[model samples]
Target: MKIGREDFEAFINGEKSITPYIETDLLAGSYSVFGVKTASNPNYLIKAIYEMYELNLNKKLAVKAVRNLFRSVGLGSVGLNNLLKKLGIDLKPSEFLMLVFKLQHQQGWGAPFELLEATDKRIILRTKQTFESQVMKDWNMQVCGIHQGWIEGVLMAVTGMNWFCLERTCHAKGDEFCEFVADQAESSWKFKAEAIVKGESAITEFIEHKPVEGTIKLIDDPVVIMPRFVFTSMMNSLKKTMGEMPAGGVNYRAYMDMGKENVEHYRKMGITKPHILADMAFTFYSQMGWFRIISMEWNEAKKEKTITLEHTVESEAFGNTGKNVCYCTAGLLAGIVEGSFGIKVQGREIRCRSKGDEHCVFAITNKPE
Candidate 1:
């Protein structure tokens, strides 16, 4: 049946109107196999097709045209086979054909399965269309011919993130340095280099001969931005080690310090009970780590279904909160438990009076499982 965007979205979200096997088979085609029958629920199918294949469609109708032309020439099978082959998809011809038909039209293949994989590699990179196209157009008009380079610089500047290839001659000098010219084979670098090599000499000229105003402005950050630079680097390191970091590094760092200090200060006020500190951490202190208690229960059984962990956590307190403790207690415990014992805590709780608070205590919890 045809699927609409909403239906596709539902199916993708793990909504259960359909069976897993059906969903799995449909997604296997990369959502580019839609035909007469699957077109019945056009809306959901279309939605899924677009959602699943949308990123692939970023470049132009070129992909659609290519696929359609292949189909028209009785090479749709060949084209689908080619894509599936690239994706390492192995399925029977009948099974693969059914999926191919669903994907060609339905667009509801949301699983990040072969469809997204095929389309992302095949389409997104070559496309000039993106959410920023309009913004780039307006920016280009405003700054004369410096629009493209300027927009790229602005993007780097605004995001406070850096991208560089290992072998690039130039790298972001610092957090705010923002631009690099590297001769590397990374995907983004290749795109930039190829764009320069093939296109209007403007992009190449712009990069080689920097735009004075843009260059100066990109590097000219105030003194206040230094702490931000440090915090960003720290967060990036943390995120790389873990899977992700809190969305806002600056806000998260500030609050985390505050939570640490609140505990320290409270202890200085002569609080000594662990429960009080745990309560404080749960209500106030734990916010900094961007932590949320996933599941905390007293495991009474002899922990067979558990493991151990260990790691060093930079400790902070309210007074001069950014300062890391010589040795952090809670972080130490978590590292030991998760790393060595193979037991993961929903979070950690600890009591320390080193920084000043007498009854200061805190718990660091994992965001969620």
Candidate 2:
């Protein structure tokens, strides 16, 4: 099953029929391991991982675990090896590293990266932005362990060699850039020190390095995003931690923030106004396989409107939590309303399929005047 640009784009656009197992196979190379859809908000995905890191209390162990998991998956059937093979590039060591960077960019991780140096014994790369760093910008921590592991995993899969990846500097640690060093040596501290000195001595050296020759151009294909299950599971984990307190409140606030960010993001793209933004939001969610929008209406006279969305996959899968568990969706809708109208509005999930309702429904209304 060769995944071409058209196929990839179709999959991202929800024009391709995807079963849970197949999607998992395509992305993570295991069959139904996640048992959910692929494609998700990167921020949500990183947050879930960060939460896990905090829960474990041992950042090293958490990072090691993540690396091992990613490595194992990358070594599996239909994984990174297969992806590289499909690209059909006869790449040198440096070119291969550049190819990896290109693949990462194509996957929508939202960062521009460069291969500063690559040799048989060592490789250095730098990025101004990274998904984890961008997501954890406010936190005082280094969150590049997963990425370090990912690089190691891919290298191992590609070269059949044990390579160690270390994050010498991180944006989360207040550095101007995130720097990664990979080598096959047992001692990585020396490489880390070198990277630090090099980064300081001539930062522009890395930035000004000419692009590698014969770079493989990545196809503008759709990325296989994560599924709703990933976010839902993370929410459920938080709920478990909250115990007696209602978890919906946390989800509401978090998702409302996300929605507001989405609005700001779209606004920069020249998408403003309630109706147009709502339609754009609906299209985005629907394309990501969240649910079908049955109806969306705006009542200017009553300062109220309603959106009826049905067949929400999250609600259908979790099945009757005895309360409206779609708080995030509600918050998102409310955020869209607020962003669109430039006024405060409230959104409520009046009916949820998870609560044994036939459809999940949301109501939006302006605040009391």
Residue-level lDDT tens digits of model 2 in 1-369: 345555433443446543422444455654321232335336787777766755833454454455545555444422534644565534555555555445445445424567888888788889986777777666655667666766776666667777777777889879988898988764232232233233211111112222365232211112344665775687779878995247777877777777777666656655555666655556556645677788887789976778888877668567778877788788888887677667887888888888878888888887775
lDDT of 1 by residue, 1-369 (tens): 454445434533446344322332455543222222221233343333333433533322222222222223332245445544555554443234334333432343211112211211111111112212222233221111111222222222222222121111111111211121212123243233233223212121223223554332111211111232344455556557664434233334444444455455445544445445444334221222322333333345533212121211232322233332312334432332333223344333343333443332444444445
Off by over 4 Å in 1: 1-232, 235-264, 287-289, 301-369
Worst 10 residues of 2 by lDDT: 200-209
Per-candidate Cα lDDT values, in order, are 0.31, 0.62
Backbone clash pairs for candidate 2 read 38-225, 38-226, 39-225, 39-226, 40-225, 40-226, 320-354
